[model samples]
Target: MKPPQLTPAALAQIRTLGSVLRVSLEPGGGCGTAYAFALAAQPGDLTHDLGSVTLALSPEVARVLTGARLDYGARLKPPRFRVLAHPNTPHRCACNRSFGVPFPGRVTPECRAYQPMLWNLPECP
Candidate 1:
């Protein structure tokens, strides 16, 4: 699978780091799942070499992050890193931390929270 594309700003965010970016995901608040970032590497992690920095995506995390991009916004208050919108996650929640439908084993409440209309109608919520 293609790795998450890192924008210029995202690359800069870890320019000074000696460790790789450890990518993971966890259940979000009634809204699918969310990306979790760290600075480390682990065994069996799916790694993507991005020249300046490496992204070590956990087995589960890699699954949900398909077609995503990493970016950094310096102008926002407190200045932070964020994921750019992508076709695979059109139902991204308002919090900007969650997206898509919740993982299986989880139910529709998570999916419905971001896209209530999807469940009620023929379109995706």
Candidate 2:
């Protein structure tokens, strides 16, 4: 499936971070019933080079993520990534998993499992 388009802001942010962002949507479960989304930061070869950044979504989530916009804000205590649904697509994850919610808040095990891997980067902090 074709990856969803990124918002201008998201594209700019990715560029500013000197990283490439990719979306992965793989089929899941029986009849592709289950789905999940994960954000990953690639391993950097050099200390200064920016690594790859990716968002992996289960096949079922591809539709929900389509046209969704990602935003960054420092207003929060620790800052965070926010997902804004497109007007034409307002669907949430059917698995009841929350992707970009604040840390320490309720999150699915699947999402939480990838947090360490996602945020494990020198540039993340």
- Per-candidate RMSD, Å: 6.2, 12.2
User: Per-residue lDDT for 7-93 in model 2, tens only?
Assistant: 556656666664554333233322221222234433421112223444444333344455665555446555544455533222234
Query: Per-residue lDDT tens digits of candidate 1, residues 26-61?
Result: 666547666777889878789988887998988765
Q: To one decimal, what is the Cα RMSD in angstroms of model 2 from the true structure?
A: 12.2
Collision pairs in model 2: none
TM-score of each: 0.74, 0.36
Note the Cα lDDT for every prediction shown.
Answer: 0.68, 0.38
Worst 10 residues of 1 by lDDT: 116-125
